[model samples]
Target: PDRIEILLGVGSMTVPRSSVEKVEMASPEQNRAIRNQWKTRYLLHEDYVPAGMENIARLLTAARDARDTARQAGSAHAADMKHESSLLARLERLRSELIRVSKRMQNASRTSSPAAYNAMVLEYNNLYAAYTVGIHELAEFRAKHPAPSDRFSFYLDSLDALRRAYESALVLPDSGQDADRARFLDRVARIIEDYSRDFSTTAVRSEHSESGIIVAVTVNDSTTGRFLLDTGAAVMTLTEQFARRLNLDTSSLPAIDIVLADGAQASARAVILPSVQVGSARCEHVEAAVIAQQPAPDIDGLLGMSFLRNFAFRIDPSSGQVTLTQFAPR
Candidate 1:
């Protein structure tokens, strides 16, 4: 057979043999092993299109088409412009609903009964499908209308909202629900890829050493040095030598308490850096701490949340690269 048909609770889906990555016996042990091996590729019955999804898809498409027509009509057509505004508002409502339903679905997957979980899954699939349609429409709209416009920012806001929703969905418990986890990861990866392609992002090459992963960081647009990538650290931290090298007035800066990786508490001066740049991804008015001693002989400081929190960042060990995309709040 050139294709395979997967039976689902609601229906079934057929896929070409070329699209099928692997095949395993439908046994619990085999399923677990396959899930472990391919965490992000496994699919489940719940991943299929649920009943009533076709209608939802049609509704979303119609709404998007109507909005596109209204937008194309321009301001001369007052009624069509009003219709477009209405459709935009409806799409925004749909996005909000999708977020709310996904949160509930997350809870259901964790603690609900089988029947209750199934019900939530159906509702979630419908909303998620509609939300995806809305995202495509927004992407198309943005393509037609470039940046520096209010509408462009609005579309970006919608995309950011979807990204956050996907992130929240990724917070599932370790309950052997590999399919759901994989689905969320696949969506998050797509969103991250889309962000990299559509928006300004920075990828900085990192050095992995015994101490930790290190990347070059520029402080106040002047002092450039290597810093340990420490997500656990509360704020950007610099050794006294590096701080003085930057000509920072540490003497007048306020002091704060910080805990070292060794679980020792120490006092450090707090400094507000005018800017911190990791590759091209920059954050201004970053808070940092100036410690008396350097963390490592070659490392100047710790790149902490103060800098990283400004962006959605991913550290890839295999590639030894840190990808940073500006986090836009909805």
Candidate 2:
């Protein structure tokens, strides 16, 4: 037979030899080493970034490695290490403030009156201009000092920080009311367009029906189903049939009391799913409940606050489109 046989713990299986792609054999020690390397390899997006940005990222990585090496070598670099720590602390504070400002701008856009929105826009524009000037100054300093020095790491860190700040600024809601502001944003978008794949905003289409707004949800990246967009639900819920399809062991899970939409009380199993995704937005370790029956015949479950809380989302009445943005806290 032109097939390969595999021995399982309690059974045997066979697969067509032609279906096999490739295989590798390694000792346990070698396998563990390879896995460790993979685990430590962060920021994989740098590989695909533009060459100039990639070079900057590599320089930052090298600076980090040098800092680590200096730390391991003991007391000789103590003063320089203290200065590095100070610069990093300042950078972190700047990043936190920028995130807070971005969140404020988003909130104002969504909920504020026209006058208030315009006021916030003016404030944000001023802050943006100030940060831009600071970034230019940092670049000028870096250009003047081409050779590596004690302050070189700070320069690279500041540039990276400003780049992230620009990304955050881009996510701010723009009503296009101000021509100057719109032009500034467009220029910033062009500068960072290549690096903004994981942009903070994502849009997912919804279906409007008698059962309410419905959106497609993916569980554990394995199963997908239409779920009613239920902001009132404290946790996501799955019908017993859907849970079974996901191979969730409801019998072994703990039971919890739930209040139904019809004002009836029922007991259901509680479970935490590995992940739940709506469009490009994904959240991990989401709490979900498994009920005995579906809420609606067409819907498999409810897309509850458990998943929605992780984002700032709005459903447009005219288009039935849901816009989700990463929620940054003030």
Candidate 3:
């Protein structure tokens, strides 16, 4: 992942947006890949977010702001000592003291022991965040212009009860395995109520065989072209012969270092493909790697989740009607 990040940063990148120009209706197989990709992205936005997450975010932001203000204020301590008068000199000393204090605050913002402090205070801040959110509901219940709705009052009571439950859940008799499991379950419930399930699992599929990545050949690479379906791979990868068919400058692709599961490393040049058609699916402007001179198998290329997540997916060995959308990504 680190090596890929470097390549993405330094490699001569093609304008990925315009890589693929050819477009056509997806065959039955391609549609499945495209459909799954769409579902993955949709699930990301709708299902991955947490409950009361906004309040926690606000608390974290406030802590960060306080920390930043302390650091900036501390920077002036050196200049404070340079003052001509004794009183000014004293003020500078105070500035230096404030800098140290601000640093402590910055640490608290990080909540990483030295990076932060006052765990009890941090807990209170989190509590206040929840309280503030609940107050909105409380205020809505007692508005004078509105007729008192018993239902709204009940909602306020329910919100307060939830807050009490949250507070109680924070207390545990001991940090045993059972307690740990309960905490985990509580967090999951909170996530389900606040955020969606998609965040817990993204649309990444990894298949590790004794050989390596699970590459399924839908079409064997021919003198003309071929396609491979790969859900386990993280990125779309293609061979040099197929890339040459698109007329792109493969030389611009940087030689990347990739570590396989078995600690084996490989060097390969990366390129953005115009498009790839696998089974009934097609991906436009997909990023792929053109491996160095090697006898590769499993079709001409493998279409990974980056292309697969652009559409919904379903697999049935009986019918083999894989489908995908080759248009704008999900």
Which candidate wins on TM-score?
1
Off by over 4 Å in 2: 1-199, 327-330
Q: List the candidate numbers ranked by lDDT, top first.
A: 1, 2, 3
The TM-score obtained by model 2 is 0.42
lDDT per model, in order? 0.65, 0.62, 0.42
Residue range 180-230, candidate 3, lDDT tens digits: 334343653464344221111122232343333333433223323434455
Estimate the lDDT of model 3: 0.42
Candidate 1 wrong stretches, greater than 4 Å? 1-198, 328-330
Steric clash pairs (candidate 2): none
| Candidate 1 local lDDT, 1-330, one digit each (tens) | 998897642246899989988865567876666545453333332233222233333433343343344334323343443544554565556655656766776566545488888887787677656645654464355345422223323334555554555455557456555655565457445545544344456899999999999999999999999999998986889998898889875553335688988889989965557789999998765667899878888999999876775566778989999987652322
Residue 203 CA error for candidate 3 (Å)? 20
- Report the error of model 1 at residue 228, Å: 0.3
Model 2 scores a C-alpha lDDT of 0.62
**Which candidate, 1 or 2, has the higher TM-score?**
1
